[model samples]
Target: MSNNRQPDWDPRSPAVFDDQIAAYDRMRGRCPVARSDYLHWSVFRHADVLRVLEDHGTFSNVVSRHPSVPNGMDPPEHTAYRALIEPYFAPERVRAFQPVCRGVAADLVGQLPAGGGVELMGGFARDFALRIQCAFMGWPAELHEPLRQWTHRNQEATLSGDRAATAAVALEFDGFVRGLLDARRKAGNAAPDDVTTRLLRERIGDRPLRDEEIVSIVRNWTVGELGTIAASVGILAHYLAAHPDLQRRIREDPSLLPAAIDEILRIHAPLIANRRMTTRAVEIGGRRLEAGARISLIWASANRDEAVFGDPDEFRLDRDSAHNLLYGAGIHVCPGAELARLELRVVMEELLARTRAFALMPDKPPVRATYPAGGFTSLALWVERCS
Candidate 1:
């Protein structure tokens, strides 16, 4: 890597932000592995992205100088933390949490105006994510608005690429989690037996987890649940609104909801990209890159790569599920995959069951979210309630 070599692309260009998916599709075609001043090297094609994922030794997940728990660590360390976190989303745990999840979904769906227009993002999607996250973590309702604001600030900081602002946001989140831990510690024997309290008791390497480690672990779960879950809700709703036929099919057979949700998300990803740093000199997509180069696995593009998915946008449940990188792949695959799937499926099922039909409002077009975020910013749809 040298300052002399010009940037292959500008990730922040106005054109790219205007419609990220379309731009990434073009990039996958034109420059599968491209470099930018902001992101260094971006691997867009499915095959190339898979290559990076499978060989974690070469493309390391520890991209940030700041700590990111298991996400920012390499093997052995990543393995231990990952093992500790996985049980929280285990099948039985996820199943036990279903009633609470469904209640949250049902309550939000009930709030939708009967047979009327609603802005899905604000009125439904974000609310569902916030409520479900708080309920899962045993957080109070009072924290929702603050957490919502924090999520917005975090996203803004990430998109701005301002390290100071990002750090400030991280500190703000840490304060919130630290307060929860402090209260639980003071309560001691009387503390609510919940996920947050349980984290305080977790042991790593024959010692109780440190406050910072607990904060990082909780922060990771919060970010994944709040951001991706919210984005997925909006994306799924908007997709269904635009495709009435698929909507009807899913409604007719609720069992199809799970596969439908996965297929739709694969077509239009909720997560944009994930970062990896090159551990050593490597060649990808016919490009030479030196060790220590930063890399972005562009999920927004890779999942829809025509090389693997044929038409890319074609909706087909029969497609091989393994090829879909909705929750990613390799060692860093999303630990909360099962939890996410359950949340998406339950919410969509409740929504479809409650509404007769939902379609895009002819007068109000949905706005696409910018980079570091995916899905709609605001989606207006007309709902026809079941009579």
Candidate 2:
């Protein structure tokens, strides 16, 4: 192992995001595990990423859990919160949201004309995600535009990694959630049940959750879902447009769409990496990470690890590698992962069913998001709008 420590891998590198198929391959060879001041120590290999996620005692998720939700908690306490929250995102709940998700996608698709094209990122991706999030959480429709604006600003601030900006966004998100919580409380049990209602009534340890904790949990789910789902949708759309045969296959047999979604998520995980702190000294990929140190587990790199995912560079929709770390692994695995899958499945299904073809504008540069998020910044597709 090299004695030199370098800044954790930078996603801003064009070579990594733009030329990803090649970038991760070379990095795994030269530096499977690199250290960065910004992301702390990063683990690129699949085994290492799995180890960190599974061993919560040694590698703490609590470091980032201040915004609450079980994501920031380790086992025991984490397990309890997950038990309360998981059922809300279970298969039945996800199934319930499918129609609503498809309606949202159909509405967006209807807005595009047969001969015209639109920037899929802002028009379709963001709007679809926002609508589904608000519907699932049962928030008022009036807050949609402001909530969308806040979501965008919050993502920008977090990716910029400015402490003040991140703090500001957090406060803004909390305030918005607090207002909603107050309204729900005033409505009392007479109001229909929704995620907010369940959260307010559920107990974590002894009594019902404190208002701040409720705000934190809701904030985590809302903010985290918005950007990631939007980016993932954009990525899948970009790929399907680039590869027509695969698109046709998915369209002909909707069964293939779900598998295709998993493969796409594995290939282009929306987030570049997530941070975790070490609670105790631990050896990962032969390097000893000391306690109090932060580590960035590069999910994109890990998903493409040659050792685990054969032909890691190619996009094979039928690969049996269902264990990809896209939603992550172990305890802090995404709480809304099933919901995300449902959203992707419904959107892809509707898009393919409605349209037979799409055209990517030539020579127009596709903007790439750096670090925190993945996928194209502005993916404008000349979609063949259906009747």
Off by over 4 Å in 2: 2-22, 65-67
TM-score of each: 0.97, 0.94
Highest TM-score: give the candidate number: 1
RMSD of each: 1.6, 2.0
Clashing pairs in 2: 6-35, 7-36, 8-35, 8-36
lDDT of candidate 1 over 315-375, digit per residue (tens): 9989899999999899989988999999999999999999989999989999999878899
List the global CA lDDT of all models: 0.91, 0.80
Best by lDDT, which number?
A: 1
